[model samples]
Target chain A: MVQFLQQIVNGLSLGSIYALIALGYTMVYGIIKLINFAHGDIYMLGAYVGFICTVQLGLGFFPALIIAMVTCAIIGVVIEKIAYKPLRNATRIAALITAIGVSYFLEASTQKIMGTSAHSFPDVLGTQTFNVLGVVISMKQIIIFVVTILLMLLLQYVVQKTKIGRAMRAVSVDADAAQLMGVNVNATISYTFAIGSALAGAAGVLVGIYYNTVSPLMGLVPGIKAFIAAVFGGIGIIPGAMFGGFFIGIVETLVTGYGSSLYKDAVVYIILIIILIVKPAGLLGKNVKEKV
Target chain B: MKKLVIALFVFAMLAGCSSNGGGNPAGDGYKIGLHYELTGEVADYGNAELEGSKLAIKLMNQKLGEDKYESVEYDNTSSTTEAVTISTKLVQDGVIGVVGPATSGASAATYQVLDGAGIPVISPSATANNVTQKNPDDENSEVYNSVFRICFEDSYQGAAMAQFAYDTLNAKRVVIYGDSTTDYAKGLTQAFTDQFHKLGGTVVATEYYVAKDTDFNGTLTKIKDMTYDALYIPGYYNEAGLIAKQARAMGIDCPIIGGDGFDSTTLVDLAGATALNDVYFTTAYTTVGASDALQAFIDAYKAEYNKEPGMFAALAFDATNLLMEACEKAGSNNPADIQKVLVDIEFDGITGSFSFDATHTPIKSVLVVELVDGVQASAVSVSPKM
Candidate 1:
């Protein structure tokens, strides 16, 4: 039981990172109906930025994290404007292809610059483990959970209570109607990208601390997994992505802890298939009739 | 349209007439082929070889001048097909001998082609048994005539470490985490497992992961309940370092051992000082050394490049000098003569003294290097009897 609880602690720590990245995927999908494949690379960029801030610029962990989030938010807005905005009226497939292109572009360019080698991410969260009820948890794991929950609450408050949030919701409902209501459609879309990218950036810094290593291609697998998390919980739903991230994380950790790790990815995909079979719109998604 | 076609044909002819650097040399200098990875996956090792070999060539040129060597350089970019192109290009350009593609796959690709051409090709560090030994099962099988290497074969390293683990570290039960993608990793894994069992050590479990995987907590957790005295991971430094870090984080205290994959400076940095405790690996040479000859080479390398020479540098230096020595012994730069001379020559190097065994691989002692306080320190030297 202690071992099981310990695995849950590991799962939560891992899941929070996925949750943060999944929020980005879910938000962009919510606003534009486009899956931003480069969202994962944004997380990678955040880690790199944080690395530079702390290592070369000699800033504290929190300062580096904030700097990375701001930098990524700006980058996210620019990427949406450049890559997706022009293709707004085009087919969804085209936008997805561009997102994938952007993802590869970020990976290749970073590999060219950084030389495809791993860098040791500085230890920000001190190396200390605390025992609670026979289960030991690291300091970084605690930070991941607390920060992720706080950010999710803040995100919920922003979307529910703010004017921009209302505009975002209106745009997601009907872009033409939102434009008629004077919502400034382009600005709302850009705001969505900024928020999503900032969340991904924060996740990137936290993951770098937990993993203690960073590489150019570090975002690829995690990005795919986070996307899976987003889809596993209704893709465009806010609460769903968060719940899905934690769920996948816990399931993955438990599977590896008690079962064969070679089948972890296979098991995750199988669960997703079962979930989709039962609820075609995702776990929390409503079945809505649409014009074909 | 006719005039444009004629003009294009003339331009193409003129482009082909241009001379590349290192293809031609004035006076009585020998033209050697510099075949190493300059811009690919293993470019770091290739770059080190280039630096060390270039330094050796420069110093040799200072003494020989006009009889100094000019090299036609080819960067394989760590691909076998690219190695073929470069090997052919080197041969067509008339190099006396070749000094490295820096990896077993690259060497395997080009060595047969170079051997067919009867050119002597020496690899700085390709360790796979088939790299030097074309016929593995036969005791008296003829060695690959034109192919030779300065590093010990793959089997030697794994066997040495296995002996060290049983006799020195006193390990009994082991778990192996092998990289299933590469022949290098697979070969080391097989060799280590065979030797370990031969020495009465039971392998508890074997796990495999592909390269580029950073997450191993899954594997760590799976192995947590299993009983194992040591972890033998046969793979590169990146994943090895990550495994060590994850293993420690999961509260596993068993000593981790591996082959030459854990040699890089990045291993210490990635694993940290505390995580690296009791981590050991076998490699060509110990980085922490103070021998007069080794120190002289190190000092000279540091003076020239403002950095300590990695093992690749030392190996490439030996390869370069070995090529030069063979050329001198043969009294000509002819491929046939150089190949003939190398078959019987013994060269002493900074890594260790070695001559070609029946397999065309150098016979040398493999060092069991251990990580102490995150710094690579020499642990023990194992001489192979098999």
Candidate 2:
């Protein structure tokens, strides 16, 4: 039972990271209907930024995290403006393909700048472990949970209460109608990217601190897993992304702990397949009519 | 305008051809190919090999006139497909032989092209047994005739580490965590498991992970519940270093053992000194205690590159000089003659003095180095009882 509880704690910590990244994918999808494959690279960029801030500039963790978030937010807006905005009226596939191209470009350019090697992220918070009921939990894990929950609440307030959030929802529901209603669709889209990418940036910094290392290609797997989490919970639904992230993380952890680690990835995909077959729309997704 | 464009295109084509030594009237050197990973995942290993090969080539030219030999270099980008493409280009370039594509997967990927072209290819550090043998799992598997390596096969280090753990460290119960994606790690894991079990040590658990995986908390948490005397990770320094760091953080402080893949200095960088305590890894060379010849090579390397030469550089220096020795023994640059002489040549290198076995793997000693606070404290030479 203690072992079970330990695995649960591990799962939740891992899940929180997936949740942070999934928020980015789901947010972009909610606003523009583009998958934004390069969102993961933005996360990678965030870690490198945090790495520079802490390692080179000798800043503390919070300052490094905020700076990384702001830098990534600007980058997110610029990427949307340059890469996706021109293809807005074109086919969705074109925008998706361009996102992939952007992803490769970011990976290759970062590899060139940083060189093909992993760097140790200096220990920002010294190691501290606590045994609660024979289950070990670290200071890093506690910080991850606190930060993720706080971000989620902040994201919810912005999405549900703010004017820009209303404009975003209005545009997602009916862009033509929202434009007719005097909503700045372009501004809303850029704002969505900014917010989403900021969350991803925060995830990058937390992961760097948690794992104690960062590399050029660190974002690839988590990006895919977060995308899966978004789809599993119901893409374009903010609450669903959070639920999906936690679910996937816990399931992956439990599978790896009890069953074969080799089959853990396979199990996640199988659950996704089952979810798709049972309800074409995700767990929290609703059916919507498509215009031909 | 169209006529001018056509004329310019023709001139550009001529320029391209001429630049490949096609139009150089004074070209008389025997061109050898240096196909290595200059960029991408394993670029560190490839770059070290490049430095070693360059130093060896410079010395070789001084010994046997400047125009006697020359090398054309290409980067395989530390990828298998890129290796195949580069090997094909080397064949078309009509080089005598090639050295490198540092990892086992990339080196093995070049076999079909180099084998059919009858080119004798040598790898400086490819350690998977299958790179030189047809099927290393089978006892009677034939050797890959033209493919050769200067380092001992993966099984040698794996078995050596197991024996060291059992006999020296007195470890009876061990856990195995390894990278599943590469033949190099898989080969080491298999040999370690077999040898440990043969010596009557109980393997507590066996786990696997793919390359580029950053998290090991779930797996480590599971392993913490089990009883083990030591942990053996058979993979490159990239993942191994992270594993060591995570394991130490989780409070599992047993002695960690590994293979030659853990030879890089970057291992210390990834896993800090505190985390790397009580770690031991098997390799073909270490600078802890060096022979006079190796000391000379180290001094020369530091003078040239302004950095210490790692195992890959040392082994690649040996591989390049050994190739030149074969060329001299054969008395020609013919690939077939070089292959014949390579089989019988007894070249003394910084790593050790050994000739290639039937499978083209060097019969050499494996050194197990112990780390104290991320510094090499001791290295004991051990021969695997095969």
Q: Residues B202-245, candidate 2, lDDT per residue (tens digit)?
A: 99888988787878888888888688899999988888888899
- Compared with the true structure, what per-residue lDDT tens digits does model 1 show for residues A26-90? 99999889999999999998999888888899898899989999989988998888889999999
Q: Candidate 2: deviation at residue B310, Å?
A: 3.5
First chain of candidate 1, TM-score: 0.98
Q: Cα miss at A110, model 2 (Å)?
A: 1.8
TM-score evaluated only on chain B, model 2:
0.88
- lDDT (0 to 1) per candidate: 0.83, 0.86
Stretches of candidate 1 off by over 4 Å are: A30-35, A82-101, A170-181, A269-281, A286-290, B1-125, B129-149, B221-225, B249-251, B300-308, B316-344, B384-386
DockQ of each: 0.17, 0.36
Question: RMSD of each candidate?
Answer: 6.6, 5.2
* Candidate 1 local lDDT, B1-386, one digit each (tens): 42245346645643553343346532234887889886545666687788889877876777676546766677687889999988887777777889997888888899777888888899988987766656545546667789988888778788888888888889999988878767778788888889888989999988876566666766677787788889999988778888898898878998999987787767877888888888888887776765787787888898998866777888888899899888988898777888888989888777888778767788777888888888876667886445
Q: What is the TM-score of chain B alone in each candidate?
A: 0.88, 0.88
Worst 10 residues of 1 chain A by lDDT: A108-117
Deviation (Å) of B318 in candidate 2: 3.0
Is model 1 an incorrect, acceptable, medium or high docking prediction? incorrect
